[model samples]
Target: MIELGKYAGTVLAAYGVSLALLAGLVWQSIVANARARRDLERQEKNG
Candidate 1:
């Protein structure tokens, strides 16, 4: 395919940073959702 000669390093670094940020966001969202669901279930059970 595609050539990546002079700009290879910059492109790779940008992609790596973006991937890391996206992964972090996904993990945080999952944890928040799980916590919220557990809290709701607990309230329902107690009430």
Candidate 2:
């Protein structure tokens, strides 16, 4: 159904890069949310 001789490597590389960037963005968003929640809790406790 598909040709893998000429474009397989390029396609795989593109997919790998896209996956890596998506993972990094998810990780960053999680870390930022955690930090914000923690800071809010700390502020509430102090004030």
Candidate 3:
């Protein structure tokens, strides 16, 4: 790990924010893909 010394808090906070945003993006994509797949299947069955 890079030694940030007194700047450690800022560096750690940046890493935390980056991880949270990445996690959110992954969760959103999964939910969206599942919803779209379900809709497509329903359309296929009805049409």
Candidate 4:
């Protein structure tokens, strides 16, 4: 890895935070999709 010298800790922390946020967004999307699909199926069955 390239040397980040004196700012390595700060840079790494920023990267970690960004990756975590991205993961959370992806997880939220998946959960939302599943819920919507289930609701749609329920509605169809009821109808």
In terms of TM-score, the best-performing candidate is 4
Q: Which ten residues in a row have the lowest lDDT in candidate 1?
A: 1-10
- Clashes (backbone N, CA, C under 3 Å), per candidate, total 0, 0, 0, 0
Give candidate 4 misplaced runs (Cα > 4 Å). none
- Prediction 3 global C-alpha lDDT: 0.99
Rank by TM-score, highest first: 4, 3, 2, 1
RMSD for each of the candidates: 1.0, 1.6, 0.7, 0.5
TM-score, one value per model: 0.88, 0.88, 0.92, 0.96
How do the residues 1-47 of candidate 3 rate in per-residue lDDT, one tens digit apiece?
88999999999999999999999999999999999999999999999
For residues 1-47, write the lDDT of model 4, one tens digit per residue: 99999999999999999999999999999999999999999999999
- Reference-based lDDT, residue 46, model 1: 100
Instruction: Please give the ranking of all candidate structures by lDDT, highest first, separated by commas.
Output: 4, 3, 1, 2
Q: Alpha carbon lDDT of residue 40, candidate 3?
A: 100
Give all candidates' CA lDDT scores.
Answer: 0.97, 0.96, 0.99, 1.00
How far does residue 31 in candidate 3 sit from its true spot (Å)?
A: 0.3
Winning model by lDDT: 4
Give the CA lDDT, 0 to 100, for residue 41 in model 1.
100
